[model samples]
Target: MRRPHPASRPAPQLRIKPPRQLIAESGADLEGHGLRRTMGLFQLVCFGVGAIVGTGIFVGLSDSVAKAGPAVVLSFALAAVTCVFTAFSFAELGGAIPVSGSSYSFAYATLGERTAFLVGWCLLLEYGVSVSAVAVGWSQYLNELLNSLVGWQLPDALSAGPGDGGVVNLPAVVVILLAATLLVRGVRESARATAAMAVLKIGILLLFLAIAFTAFQAGHLSPFATHGAGGVTAGASLAFFSYIGFDAITTAGEEVKNPRKNVPIAIMICIGLVTLLYCAVAVAAIGGLGADAVGDKPAALSLIVNQVTDSTVGGGVIAFGAVVAIASVVLAVMYGQTRILMSMSRDGLVPRVFERVSPKTATPAVNTWIVALVFAVPAAFASLDAVVNLTTIGTLAVMAVVNVAVVALRRSEPELKRSFRVPLYPASPILGVGFCLYLMYGTGWATWLQFAAFLVVGSLVYACYGRSRSRLVAPAAPGA
Candidate 1:
């Protein structure tokens, strides 16, 4: 066999990084990443729920209900099951891979550098657009709350953003900026805010369920399967976006206390908790308000409250919850985006700027700001659904890839210490990959176009930069 000439040799970064090497890099102490390990299981759980239960439930539920009618309850169930399978993959990887890049980091450990770049690129889409989507949801609910409490509404020019019509989404921009400011402060502070928001939003959903049950009518469920199987499938695919944030727990692996144990447990617990809340809310909305009413209602939860009590005061509470939910989601998604970028930077896939952490805050301050800046543009200018489908498509693709990585690692790294393991082995990971692909196909063609375009641009960036600056290439080497 002839070796390639040195002149024709591919760069070292183009080679696969060994799992043990990735693990050793992650296990380093005071590596100057400036990230602090401080989050406990409670905070990790809060981050998961805070990210999982937001815009999808608050602002986007009507979209799902409209797509599937009363069958949206079933849609939520299907989406939840799909998420559970993926969550197991995440659990095992999170326990085994000590990096903070979430799936991006996992892919690097199990797959290779180029694959890791793709995963991180997809994550950038998933997290950044998710933050925008959640912020838009917050704006919608905030408008509802203002109308209910003070009898005022911001006209579409100010409330709606680019694709939605206005020059900019002022409210969404405001909230994104607020979350970025909080992130600039520190991670612990961010977790505290997340916990508070989680508590309030969960209470709000429980309250909606209680009030909705009083007005629940069996007749409203007459045509539970309105759109039949097809609509339910579409709804499930869109509903999958809600669970996008659960895997975010893995991104905090570097910051969480006892990450090997805590990260996996948090991922499962967060998925389970969010699933129950989603199902209950769906049942309450459909049974009490009927599918048609739920679809027509802009503020579904608030409308349910007003229907039960026939008063704006009750609507106010539900609207408040939406506000809190959207705010928390934006914060958590931003956190995930920054951590992934930081991890990529540590590996030299991107500029080192994103990896630098603020010594004072013990957070990736610059990276956090960059993320907020990146998403704020879309939040301010783009329409709500403009980026929603793109987010889902990218996420499903990454999840599918992560599932593949799980199977790959099972055979290649059997001796690695893992605090959590995927039960049922091959079946679970295979199902995870299947579920993600099924949902990806469910996403519309336009979304696939957007996703493809984004990856093309990402590849260009990588070819120009990652090909040269990757950490795998030593500075002393002449051909580095």
Candidate 2:
């Protein structure tokens, strides 16, 4: 056969990491690249709960209520339904792949290196911005707790960001730094601390529910759909932030024992537990105090508790719980951010510095510190509402990509070992993608523009750095 001219030949296809190769590399004991597997089912579940049950319920609930009124309960339900679909996709992929990169790794195996890089980039926004948003919420609750205990609170100028009439949010920065410190010490220690805090915070929320229910009034639920379907959809977009952490369980795939089995189980359990608590809390808060009263109030849960019981003690307890709850979120989500970067670094998609694991701590010390410092700047100066919306949109986009990836993998790797599978296969993953898109649509156009800008920057980074340096990319000819 005649040789084809180089100019006439088709261009090379996008690089892909074989699923089998990814599996083997994940299992190999590569020096300086290994993450210790210390988490069991209980620890993993705790990590998920720690990440899931925080600012969204304690602080952001008011925002959702403002948009949807008493029907914010329906908003929570809508968001939970979206999450359930995505969670099914995540569970199937996490079990099949069992890698720390989460959706990014799944994309690399099924889609292509370029698609995987974008997914990873989107995750950076999802996780890093989420930490900042959660930290800001923590500051609000911290201020509430301080007032309850000492009859004093931080000035608005000190406790809030520039967009919220504050020059800087000092407490937000402090909490993020504290979480970074714990992460640097080690993952096992962090998981134990998170588990304890997770249990305590759950008890505290239950207490709020118990006390608030005593004052429940059916009349408060009148005119539930204040803003109608549009409001509920918008509220659902914001409420989606509450469920961000369930997939954080998947990000710990490399650090969990029997990951293929444990990761999926933890995810399902976490989602069910979190959704139930969130819906119940929403009902209790709205029932105790009308939606108009709760909407837009800082530390709204604490205020509701105080009003319902005519005492500051209940409010103080809830404030303290919010502080602990939001702190755990910062810790757990930041951990996920560092792990995702570590996986990208290993694939030569990001700088090698991020891949460094401390010998003494078995943690990505440098990566953790860098992420904390970078994200803390936003926590200090950026508006909470802006970051929350941005994070939600980015997360939804990433989840949509994961849903598509699951379908792609099934088609391409039919015989691959999977510890768990999406119940409805094609239909389930298809619905997952549709739900993610629907929620993303509910976000404001400003966020879409911001996301577009982010993707542009990411494309440039991959073009100039990641694409050339990626491990799967073949080297150029010496004299080409």
lDDT of 2 by residue, 1-480 (tens): 998999999998868897777767666223214688888899999999999999999999999999999999899999998899899999999999888888889899999998999999999877888899999999999989999999999999999998999999999999999999999999899999999999999999999999999999999999889899999999999899988878888889888888889988999999899889999999998899989988968688999999988988889999999999999999999999998998898788999889888989999999999999999999999888888888899999999999999999998899998999999778988998898899899998999999999999999999999988887765324432
Quote model 1's TM-score. Answer: 0.95
TM-score of each: 0.95, 0.96
Q: How close is candidate 2 to the true structure, as a TM-score?
A: 0.96
In order of listing, the candidates' clash counts read 2, 0
For model 1, state the Cα shift of residue 109 in Å.
1.2
Sliding window of 10 residues with minimal summed lDDT for model 1: 25-34
| Best-matching candidate per TM-score | 2
Clash pairs detected, candidate 1: 162-381, 163-383
lDDT of 1 by residue, 220-275 (tens): 87788889888998888888887889988988887888888899999989988999
Q: Quote the lDDT for 281 in model 2.
A: 93
Candidate 1, residue 131: Cα displacement in angstroms equals 0.9
